[model samples]
Target: MKRIQIEKIFHHNAYRIGVFFDKDFEVIAILKRIGATYSGSRRCWYLDYSKASYHKLRFHFPDLVVVTESSNTTLVTGINNRDLSPIASSSVLQLDSTLSNPEHKQTQITSEKLKLQLLPSIGKYWVFKMHFHHEISKQLLKIKGVYWNGNYKSYMVFRNETVKQHVEAVLGVGSFFGSDYFTKDLLPVKGKIKILPHTEATSWMEVYVPKLVAVHEKLKRFSLARFSKSKNCYLLPAAPIVMDSLHLQFESTGIDIENLLPKNYLDKRNLPNKKQLDLSKTKKSLLDMVPVQAQTYLSSMIDTLLALNYSSSTLRTYCGAFIQFLRYFEFRNPESINREEIIRFLGSLMERGLSATSGHSMVNGVQFYYQQVLGKVDYSFVLPRPKKEKKLPVVLTMEECLQIFKVVDNPKHKLLLLIGYGAGLRVSEIVSLKWSDILFEEQKIHIKNAKGKKDRMVMLPYSIVTSLQLYRELYKGKHYVFEGQFAGEPYSTGSVQQVMRNALKLTGLEKKATVHTLRHSFATHLLENGTDIRYIQQFLGHSSIKTTTIYTHLTKTAVDKIQSPLDRMVDLKSKKKLEE
Candidate 1:
């Protein structure tokens, strides 16, 4: 499950908040109830900048991390006007003293005068509007609290008396007290650049140039500018110096440079390797290379799936198979394509090493598109389906399973393996297990939302109960019985697989088995110990008895009970010799 993140941005004289969530309906309903309005332009929700709005957000989402650009010193206090009387009065007094200074008279009457105007903004900040004069602007930019706001076309400074007085003294009162300031005319020649996260490993930046100002040839060449069709913007590799130059250029354009990029962008750790970067590029290329008509058909297929209430996983699988089918035919018109073409395509897939199960899935996707979407009843693409493989699942001997447990020293790893085998839980089911799912009193594991969205109860072995308690004490999981680094997040399936692999290697087991093999061993062992087939089916969450019967082939109970005809013949021969 994706965690919720609330990012508060000070944009266009208001606090624009963007929420990243996993589409939980209750959370969205809460946001709507709080009077937060969504903005299509910015792709986020917003409320007028105020203390009450911020508090309301905090109230609704108490645990969500709020990402902000402002420094700790400049954090908004969310205090009422009645509470801000002292600070307001002190600021007015400081302005009075700066205006009465007699020592600054000469410098005030210079040829090119600087003008500063302060306007009250949201929270404890003031918008300082001014025009650019080459010499004086440099001096103003050097101040710690002063920074430009691009969207507002003004500078922002902490509402502090000392900072305001210092600005007046530097600009000279004559230069600071003019009403002819125009921020639009003073817009920086070089435009804004924004760096954002593309993935965990990669970073991408967008270059938004001013209409009048042309991009510098040297900067463009150094950055190796490439246009991304998906983003509809030019992108550059997020090198450290390149990012610094982009920020410096935008800051020169008069935008405040506070936390311009994400916190992780500057860190020189776990950067994307060449292969990862190439894979991203390849995915983009494939998306862009898709023909327009094929994209239309793909969208129609997705819409149909949604209308029919198909599961998300099924929709994703079908769409992927359809995309491959379209690409194979160079995205030919779907209406013009015939059954023979689809038959040829399925044959081609087999020739290229596609498994029978995958080929069946592809056929289903195409059949759905034509029969359901196009309303074609006679779309007969009857190709010989490949025979399903009847290979028995690899089961670990009891001794080998014990050996694996002995080698896995980490308590978490041991518990994960033991639970998988002990409770006959699938890999996905095991990772998704929450603390509430474990009924300690009943000694049953409540396996909710298993395969086919069915829920069942499984026996929790008494032998591992103490071990489970110890692991829980060591990890202190917040939600999931096994949690990842982040609180409330489930432990990853990949991590569990790695633990299994390491155990197998340490035990020197040559069997081609995975984490699911533990589940297989559990069912087979239960069958060997005289467990009913119906109970085994329920334990494994199998929809059909035939599915559960596969374990019967691996069990030795029935075979061990039968005496061979050869053994009976040997007994008769021995008896006849004794009689003689």
Candidate 2:
């Protein structure tokens, strides 16, 4: 028996909120009451409840004058706030008392009777009850797997032949017959059925037919309801049977339906069961399950790699990448995507005006979103990153670099440029540096929470020691070494870039160089002075030796040191001529 109750009703000027309760007195429905508010000059308004019953109870009901047929499903219009749980549960008793006959029970009102009454003019195929199920079945039928139909419900089998035997023993031959009768007599007229002869005589009959898919799906929902009630016990009569069914289906077909069950729904840990988590809200609004917000997806992805508490800059970069992915696909729903779609999307990005390095970053960003946040497997083949071009790192000459240092007038700005170039720090790393990170005695700076969130130390050159000392005398802040022009804020990367640009213009050296060029010059000059490539890589905080190799081409040290074969031969001939 299904019992529905009205939990609450609130009336406003032209709107209301109605809450409903089920047989268990659990809140099952929240109805939005929409009404018309019109001035004397406005058009007339009408409220319809015929279709609203499928979702929830509302404040207004359809006018009987317009829908005169009582068989069209009665609408409890304009109902005052009342608790209907007890009334609905005792519907049979009240109904029986009204009829004054034991034979005239509420159970006699089968799906056929109610269906016909609701739409008497329609054919059997157009039965209202069948129509409702057919619409809802569209979602359930998408699940391709093996399941069993109880008398009026369906359940996906998990495993265990013993559980099947138990269900069969309890059900007997009536299992098949009951299922058939329920489908033909109680279900909508258009519904299909499959009846089979008993195979083992336990209680179940080996029924095999595709039409049973719908029945199994509908019954599965009812079984979930039962599981929700029995918080701390075996889920069903045949747990082993359900389990074995899932295994058998998976073995025969590659689809793994068992994993499709929400992790929070079933608890297998310690083999213990707790009160089932509320899935009604989730089930009712399937759209909410998708990661609609880019921030939500990015936030979740970052939590897996780093702690949930990450810097705001890290959060923005991760989220921006994810959002760009969604925009590239025109914000297509993730459900519509597959491996090939991702492959094509990544491939198309190559010619869409993005540089190879930028494309590589995008691939990493999109890959992390799907594989980590979405929990999708088989993404290894989707992301095909483009090859980066091999090019020498741009470096400034020592004279030009000195000229830039001399041009910067602000003491704090001068120190920032010196450190960024001096220590080979990324723009982000420069902003995050603190006063305590510097160790004057050791002539090193502790780069804590650097790129990839790893900690490392960098050398502090003696040349810049005096400059830093002078800047500290002027600024004297406790935390950040490079404080913004405004009192307490850390200087941003934009501000630093502006400082570098202004310095370049003032020095009259405009070769289109960035703040990073200073670090490149530092590396190139160190290489020229005979610093090992491996040492340069560590000092520059390179994750790979390959990244540091670009500076080798710019150093000119190797080429300058080489004695060309032509030069040796020319020198020998010249010496012979002189001797002759």
The 0-to-1 C-alpha lDDT of every candidate, in the order given, reads 0.64, 0.49
Alpha-carbon runs more than 4 Å astray in model 1:
1-293, 302-316, 348-354, 372-384, 563-580
- Model 2, 285-323: lDDT tens digits are 222323465335444565653444444444444544555
TM-score of 2: 0.45
State the lDDT of candidate 1 residue by residue for 322-416, as single tens digits.
77778777788888877788788778666655656677778788888888888777856465676666779999988888999999998888899
RMSD of each: 25.9, 29.4
Best by TM-score: 1
Which one is best on lDDT?
1
Q: At residue 50, give the lDDT of candidate 2.
A: 25
Off by over 4 Å in 2: 1-318, 377-381, 562-580
- 18 Cα displacement, candidate 1 (Å): 44
Model 2 local distance difference test score: 0.49
